[model samples]
Target chain A: DAGVTQSPTHLIKTRGQQVTLRCSPKSGHDTVCWYQQALGQGPQFIFQYYEEEERQRGNFPDRFSGHQFPNYSSELNVNALLLGDSALYLCASSLDLIQETQYFGPGTRLLVL
Target chain B: AQTVTQSQPEMSVQEAETVTLSCTYDTSENNYYLFWYKQPPSRQMILVIRQEAYKQQNATENRFSVNFQKAAKSFSLKISDSQLGDTAMYFCAFITFVGSQGNLIFGKGTKLSVKP
Candidate 1:
């Protein structure tokens, strides 16, 4: 069983540009969540999706959004990126929306210049 | 505010030695879940251990165990026989849900260095 996988291990974009990171949850998982980790800090929840609908969101702004597909894959899109948006974007998936153990991906390192 | 706190910013232990990382949490819910995740240089977040607040006995997974004090709202991780591979950033997290509004709250993390 392949674990969670993320695309474009590293990305570079200029300020005001839009970027989209992709994630494939572990096999047999249904829920996907996104998190942003700044340098020397822990990850903060961005949002969570299940059944192809966004179920919960964190304290992030409207610029950050996500979508979940029928196959359980998810995408995190950031609009009007800022230099401070340079951080590691991690995707985690669980069996459901409940408090289950979440499997995480290696994460996409976004560098906004 | 619901939060998790890791007071130690850094910790070190010699190979084969034991080390303890401290964590404290604040939450209004009586039943919740706690977790310890390890992030290495590769940037992959890995779950090391988990504990349920309703369980009285501490959870143990081989060399990793937790000392959970529900009354004090403390959850500390103890790593035994530390190895070089054990070096990583350890984060403590708390999760509580009312309906479907649950999200993990993670701490700043503690960098663990296992020396040779």
Candidate 2:
């Protein structure tokens, strides 16, 4: 079975630019969540998508948004990025909706230069 | 809001030895879940172990075990017979059981170095 997969292993962008990261949920999984991990720090939850709608969100600003397709794949879009936006964007997939164990992907590294 | 705390910023363990990473969380909810995730140099958040709040028995997976003290709101991860592969940043995470939304709150993380 294939685990969660993310695209654009690495990216470079400038301040005020926009970037979108993609993720394919693990087989048999339906829920997708996004997280941001800065260097030497733990990941901070961005948001979660279920049934093609955002069910939960963290303290992130409106610049951060996400979409979940019918196939359970997800995309995280960040607009008007700031220097702090440069971090590793991780995608996690869970089988259930009630805070079950989440399987994570390799993550896409974003660098705002 | 739930908050997880990992006091140890860095820890070192000799190969084949055991190391314990401490974590404490603050939550008002009676029911919740806790997790320990390991991130190696690859930066992938790998689930190491999980413990349900209602379960009195501690959760263990192979060489990884957790000491969950519900009264004290503490959850510590114990890695036995550590190996070079165990060297990584370990994060403690928490989530409440209030809703279908599974939002995880994570600690700063503890960097574990296994010396060969």
Candidate 3:
């Protein structure tokens, strides 16, 4: 019964570069959502993926995109990263859309310098 | 769009005492859900408790409980017999009944410090 897992607990990227964060959904879960948490702030929704398609997205720029694989794993890609992109990226897995409780991962901390 | 607000940016409580974190939300819809998530220093987001809009009894989990006021659109979390482990950043989240397609709106969060 493994919970949601994310890769690269910490990462460093340079401005104008690109970074990819990976997430594996919890067992028995199908939906995957991504969030960004800045220092001392709560997480803000990035987007959600279901059935290999992005279902809903937050007020993020086009530079932020995501993909969900057949195995329910997800990858968040940020292109042309800026220093403001530096934050903790959290991955959550839920069973369905309607008010389901989501289980979250430890999150990947990205530092852009 | 639904919005959640946590006015208190920080709070402190003595160990073995009780503390309450405040939260309020605005939504036009009749049905929705609310949640309290705790993010400790490790950065793992843990669900503390949740409340469905239709439930009037409120929701409780162990030492954590919620005071849900539908009319006031207020949802506050109360932690009793607080321990050092309970120190964390607490966030209030809201979601409508429209299903998973709706995104969760989170408050700015309240940082709780438990003094031993």
Candidate 4:
């Protein structure tokens, strides 16, 4: 019974560069959501993927995008990274859209240099 | 817009003592959910406890309990007989279903240090 897992525990990217962070949701779950936690701040919603399509997105700009695969894994991509993009990227998975509590991955720390 | 607020930024509790972290939220909806999540230095978010708006009885899990006052929009966590392992950043969160989507909103967090 593996929980949610994320890849590249940490990443460093320069301005104007692109980076991809991956997430494998907890077993027996199907919905994946992404969040960004900045230093000294709580996580802010990024977007969520359901049924391989984006359901709802937060106030993030178009530079942030993500994909949900058929296997329920997800990848968060950030383009033209700015120093402010540096934060902890978290992936949370739920068994369904409305009822179940979400399980989170350890998260990927993204450092935009 | 719904928002959760945790006023205490940092607090310390002597081991074996009790400490309560305060939280207040703003929302117009009558039905929703509130959660307290603990994040240790390792950064994995763990659910501590949760409360539903309509439930009158406070939610409790062993040494962890919540005082949920729906009318006052206040939800606070009380940890009894605190242990050093309880030290972590505690976050208050809000979520509500609208049609079918509910985005979790979290407060800045309260850092609790259970000192031995």
Candidate 5:
């Protein structure tokens, strides 16, 4: 079976620009979550989507948002990006909203100038 | 809020040797879950092992095992017969059961280097 997959392996953007990262969750999974991993640091949770609605969110600012399609694919959008936004964006998917175990994707690398 | 801490910033072990990575977490919830994820140079967060709070027995997967002291809020990962492939950054993560959909809180990570 296919595991979680993400698009746009790498992206380059300037401050104030917006970027969207895509994710295709693992087969048989329904919940999707986003995370940001800065250089030399572990991933920090962004938000989680279930039933096409955000069910839980981290301490991220409003500039970060996400969407989950019926097929369980997800998109992470960052607007008015800052230099700190340059990091690896990871996508994870679980079997359901209640399942705590999540399978993660390789992640998309974003560089903000 | 929950926090995961990995005390060792870097660790090294010779091939075929054993290494242990330490982790501690702070949480008020009685029921939760802990995990150890391995991220190689490719940067894929691969699940190494997981331990449920309520389960008294420690979790083990092949050569990887965890020493989970729930009462002390400590979780340490022990890698046996380490190989070159085991050289990577290992992160400890936690998630509480209070919020069914709560996301994982990861530690800063410990970089493990296996010398051949």
Candidate 6:
């Protein structure tokens, strides 16, 4: 019974560069959502993926995008990264949209230089 | 839009003692859900407890319990016989279903430290 897992526990990128973070949702889960947690702040919703299509998105710019594979794994891509993009990227998965209890991964720490 | 607020930025409790963290949220919807998540130094977000707005009885998970006042829009977590392992950043979150979508909102968080 593996829980939600994220790849590249940490990442470093430069301004104007692009980066991709990966997430494998918990077993028996289908919906994946991404969140950004800045230093000394709570996580802000990025977007959510369900049925291989983006269902909802937050206030993030177009530079932030994501995809969900058929296996329920997800990838978050950020382009033209800015120093402010540096934060902890958290991936949460729930059984379904109606089930609000989301299990989160350890998160990937992004550091933009 | 809904917002959750944790008034206490930090708090401390003696080992084996009890501590309560306060949270207040703003929402106009009638049906919703509230949650308390614990994030340790390791950075893994763990769900502590949850409360459904329609339920009158407070939700309790062993040593963890919540005081949910729907009219006051308040949800507070009480940790009994606190342990060192309980030290972590606690976040209050809200979820509500509107139309065909659901929204999850989180508060800044309250850092709790249990001193031995």
TM-score of chain A of each: 0.98, 0.98, 0.98, 0.98, 0.98, 0.99
Residue-level lDDT of model 1, residues A6-80, one tens digit each, is: 999999999999999999999989999999999999999999999999999998999999999889999999999
Which DockQ value does candidate 1 get? 0.83
Candidate 3 Cα deviation (angstroms), residue B41: 0.3
TM-score (2 decimals) of chain A in model 1: 0.98
Off by over 4 Å in 6: none
Task: Please report how far candidate 2 places residue B51 from its true position, in Å.
Answer: 0.7
Give the per-residue Cα lDDT of candidate 6 at A80. 98
- Higher-scoring candidate on DockQ, 3 or 6: 6
Q: How many Å off is the CA of B8 in candidate 1?
A: 0.5
Query: What lDDT score belongs to each candidate, Candidate 1 first?
Result: 0.95, 0.93, 0.93, 0.93, 0.95, 0.95
TM-score, candidate 1, chain B alone: 0.99
Candidate number with the higher lDDT (1 or 2)? 1
Residues forming the 10-long window of minimal summed lDDT in candidate 4 chain B: B94-103
Q: A34, model 1: CA deviation in Å?
A: 0.2
Q: Write the residue-wise lDDT of candidate 3 on A1-113 in tens digits.
A: 99999999999999999999999999989999999999878889999999999999998999999999999999999999999999999999998655368989999999999
Clashing pairs in 3: A97-B100
Residue-level lDDT tens digits of model 4 in A1-113: 99999999999899999999999999989999999999889999999999999999999999999999999899999999999999999999999878647888999999988
TM-score of each: 0.99, 0.97, 0.97, 0.98, 0.98, 0.99
Which ranges of candidate 3 are over 4 A from the true structure?
none
Off by over 4 Å in 2: none
Residue ranges of candidate 1 with Cα displaced over 4 Å = none
Per-residue accuracy of model 4 over B1-116 as CA lDDT, tens digit each: 78889999999999999999999999988889899999999999999998988899999999999999999999999999999999999999988888888888999999999998
Interface C-alpha root-mean-square deviation, candidates in order:
0.9, 1.2, 1.5, 1.0, 1.0, 0.9
Candidate 2 lDDT tens digits, B9-46: 99999999999999999999988889999999988789
Error of 1 at A81 (Å): 0.7
Q: Is candidate 1 or candidate 2 better by DockQ?
A: 1
